[model samples]
Each structure stands twice: as C-alpha cells, then as structure tokens.
Target: MLGVRLDTELEERLANVARTQGRSKSDIAREAVRRYVELHDEAFRREARRQSQRASRRDTQEDYAFWEQAEREDAAWR
Candidate 1:
C-alpha cells in the first residue's frame, strides 16, 4: 500500500495513457515498479557473481604462489 504523488502535468499524461490503454493508472504503476525491481535485482545478482569470481581468482593465484615458493624451498634443501 503505497501512495505516489505526481505533478499536474505528469498526472494528466498518466491519465491519457491509462484512458487510451484501457487500464487503470494503478495497474501501469504496479507493472512499472515490478519491472524496476526485477531490473535492479538482476543487476545486483550479476555484481555479486562478478565479485565472487574475482575472489576465486585471487585465491587461486595466492595458492599457486604459495606452492611455487614451497617447491623452491624444497629444491634448495636438496
């Protein structure tokens, strides 16, 4: 249950669109909000995935470096 305030000009535009589309302004607003939420949700998911991939790559590189150093130390002992 949310109330939105639109300016006079915008209100008229919305009214015209609603009249032509044979739909209520509330319906149009609801669909717009739904799409907005979905778009941002997908963007958030993509960023999270990218961050996870970056962290995984960093961890893999660190592990490789550690093993390489260990190998060098072992060769020196031999």
Candidate 2:
C-alpha cells in the first residue's frame, strides 16, 4: 500500500473518475503507471533503433541540394 497527497482539484477529479468507473484510486494509479511504462519503453526502443541506424551509416550527406537550389534562385532574383 502507498500513501499519496493530491491537490484539491486533482483529488476531486480522481474521486469523480473512481465513482464513474467503479474503480478505486489505487487501481487508476496502477493502470496509469502501466500505460506510462509501456509508452516510454516503446519510445526508448524506437530511439535506440534510430541511433543504431545512424551509427551504422558510414557517411553523412551535406545539404548540397538545398544550397544549390538557393543559389539558383538568388541568381534569378538578382
């Protein structure tokens, strides 16, 4: 068991949710914790995969295409 302190507004809202859903605040808290863990775990995994892919990339490309296009536009504008 755990004891937590909540502000008046949050306490009212939690109580309302508990009554409407026929659940205890503890149950709601448990579900929220579960959801947070699952969401962040998936997020971390995705970021790790992206980092690994970037690490495996041997060479990084410069934004030469954009620079070239900008130069061409500037030449036309002049």
lDDT of 1 by residue, 1-78 (tens): 999999999999999999999999999999999999999999999999999998877867789899999999999999
lDDT of 2 by residue, 1-78 (tens): 667888999989998999999999889988988899999999999999999998677343445676788999999999
> TM-score of each candidate?
0.73, 0.65
Runs with alpha carbons beyond 4 Å of true place in candidate 2:
1-3, 59-78
Question: Would you list the clashing residue pairs of candidate 2?
Answer: none
What is each predicted model's overall lDDT from 0 to 1?
A: 0.95, 0.88
Q: What TM-score would candidate 1 get against the native? A: 0.73
